[model samples]
Target: MNNWTRKHNKFSVQNRLTPTARELWQWLLDEMPEGSNEIIDLRDFNKWVKRTRGFPHDRKTVKSAAQQLLDKGVLTQAKSYTAYVWKWRLQPIRVLMPPPFRKPQKKLTFQSEIPNLDPSNPQPLKDEYLTTTTDLEDAESGEFEQKLQACRKAGIYYYPKDAQFMHGFSLQEVLKAIIYFLFNRDGVRHPEGWFKVCLEDNWAGKEKERHQLRVQWSTEGLFEAIRYCNQKMGMA
Candidate 1:
């Protein structure tokens, strides 16, 4: 499955918001569904906010974030019946589109419009070496062994130096991602060399995908988890 939250993942960074403001704003984006008119009474919201880490039901902090979004045209607030009812709005996701056609000087070639066939592009390539079942088995024969060995050898060369990283991600988790990438990606000239590169990003893209599907989770899933924690702590 494709990443549904990918577009929203970097929201705070893209908006250049302060840490507290970003948290509050992101809470809004994640609290209600996109393109939704679900209005939260400021009082109820502040009650919930008190259960969170930052902003803590502070009207000044909350309003500051809401106004920032308003000024940036990212959200809107409404007042009706002489009550301060605020609804955090989300901008419709903007998709990148190429400009309208610019007529070519002498018409284009079929190859020009398509992306180059680079492994970095992550497109699947035809396996000219693996035609028959025997050939396929031979190709993958020692690949996993090599990858597992590499994983062990580089046990210290990964994130979560201990299991304290997010959700207890550790060496085994890293190896799983490496193995999946090895099997699914374009041809790798060297297993060890390829895995070395994967370690840089901690194979986070793959882990996030798995987490998304496993929990059927979205940003809102974060809220549910937090709420549970808050309840256990007698804060909610």
Candidate 2:
């Protein structure tokens, strides 16, 4: 039983969402109870996607689509509701739209508003964030460097390929996550384990993002190919 309305197309146009993402948006709207303020678990949403749709979409895909929606301001994460750090998998997300009926609305408390938790979009960080874990060895004074050192000291094993994979995000973001967890900003009891999960999930999301970009790039080539074929046919 789908609760989607024709109005969903408005979201698709507004957000420029892909077909899959548009479908996922409708799915969320259908699953969410009207006038309820509960957080939705991403894992459950992922499972529903696999079962309902013929295509074999995994949880990571749902997560990226969810993040894309979040970025586009279609969805929202309740970072302040939880005592612990609010990474994607660590915490649930909620649809931002108000319920149909009049009900008591909960005030929002966001973790992104927190000091160290507030990192900018994934871009080149300023000079202060460029240092490697090795450079942090002697000084150990700066908070950013200390976090990188702590990740290494925590027995987290990162190899060359893993390092390359993480290169997509600014080193500053990684270090911030580590230190923020250490400070119990998210209130995670096992910071090390949760960080590891967040790292893997974040990397998977980045790879999916890369793949989507590549697909968009290929579309241009596809149009060029069609034009070339038509020109040759005209000549013949």
Candidate 3:
């Protein structure tokens, strides 16, 4: 696997890693032979980044990042000083979109004023809206059930009210919340509580943003690889 190279491939949870942390991980995967332990000296990594990544990182910064990775379980400290070991893990779960969840509805325009309407009569409008949107309600309910089952599979149980609250968001957004929970759940003791807070604060959007950033970073890496190859061919 030493010569194995993957390009334009998506990482399991790229947004969870900082730049230095990610570089350190890549360095471990590259420099450490399989079933071997090596000292994680940042000075050597500094040279590597200068030569390959076209940038330089201070030893202190790299060391701090390494420590952070250790604390986060991304790297394990070996018995020897400064030496570390890395492990491979399964990829994150992917959320598959089922058939069109809901049909788009035409825009609704409310009248400036309604004549012959009693101020005390509130049931008519509410009942009419519910009747008109029954199909939409059913679609959203089905989608909510799908997301609930997914969370259950991931061992994230949501209460009845919690499920109702989550139903307010799109299924894709809710799934992002689940992904966020799974990726960053290293020290979380109460997953259900964490998920409830996540829903209340709408952390799903943050996950979506991270996903976008990961895609952008991956694209940049792909281009950098291409440029490196071009430079090497030119030298040859």
Candidate 4:
């Protein structure tokens, strides 16, 4: 959900990695939110690993694993301010769904249905959106329409261009951005104008309560769908 981070399929990225290197790479992915742009301090991670694994691995041991990931282009080292502290960023290679081979297949569709609100009896907002996926034009466009409808249902002013601009994020993330606007829209004269800025920066992912809501689909889910496509192609 982090703006700087992108969703990737863990299984796909785990391909062809050494056991130690794979473990370390998986740890980095699990330790941080998907697509997080924050720099990871390896010293702290190593300490945490020692506590969890019940064995103190030498600095060289962990560094060797990191080196493997670096060589494989799974991680990138950042310019660190101190020699003692090493900062690293996970950068998984982009994997695409292989094209259909034998025959044409149905398009993947993501379904979302917002509850029709009763104006006479106002109730507190809940995670009441009903969702189901089926065949559609594409996941992003279908999700955009669903999210747009949800915004209208919630009395939020969401524009088509705004939805199109934010099509890069998954359905759930886009919904979270909408929820973020609602939670923070108090005292603002123009909710629509403020929402544009929120979408640009993705303030929803930063909110603590944003994680509490049940999201319909995540960016990771989209990539997982791609993985499914790859599996169908016998390339996963």
Q: Which predicted model would earn the best TM-score?
A: 1
What TM-score goes with each of the models? 0.35, 0.32, 0.32, 0.32
Model 1: per-residue lDDT, tens digit, 56-145? 434675666566656655565443332446655556445212234533344333444446754333223224422553564454434434
Off-target runs (Cα >4 Å) in candidate 2 are: 34-36, 80-236
lDDT of 1: 0.48
How high a TM-score does candidate 3 get? 0.32
Better of 2 and 4 by TM-score: 4
Cα lDDT tens digits, model 3, 17-111, are 44455556556666665344555555777788667434566666676667665555544533434342223331111211123344444344554
lDDT of 2 by residue, 155-236 (tens): 4444322232232234576765555445543565544445644553564456568989787787779899899999999999
The C-alpha lDDT values of all candidates are 0.48, 0.50, 0.58, 0.55
Q: Write the residue-wise lDDT of candidate 4 on 166-226 in tens digits.
A: 4444568767877877776676566654554465456766565465543666788889999
Which candidate should be chosen as best, given lDDT against the real structure?
3
Ranking by TM-score: 1, 4, 3, 2
Candidate 3: pairs in clash: none
Winner by TM-score between candidate 3 and candidate 1:
1
For model 1, name the residue pairs that clash: none
The candidate with the higher lDDT, 1 or 3, is 3
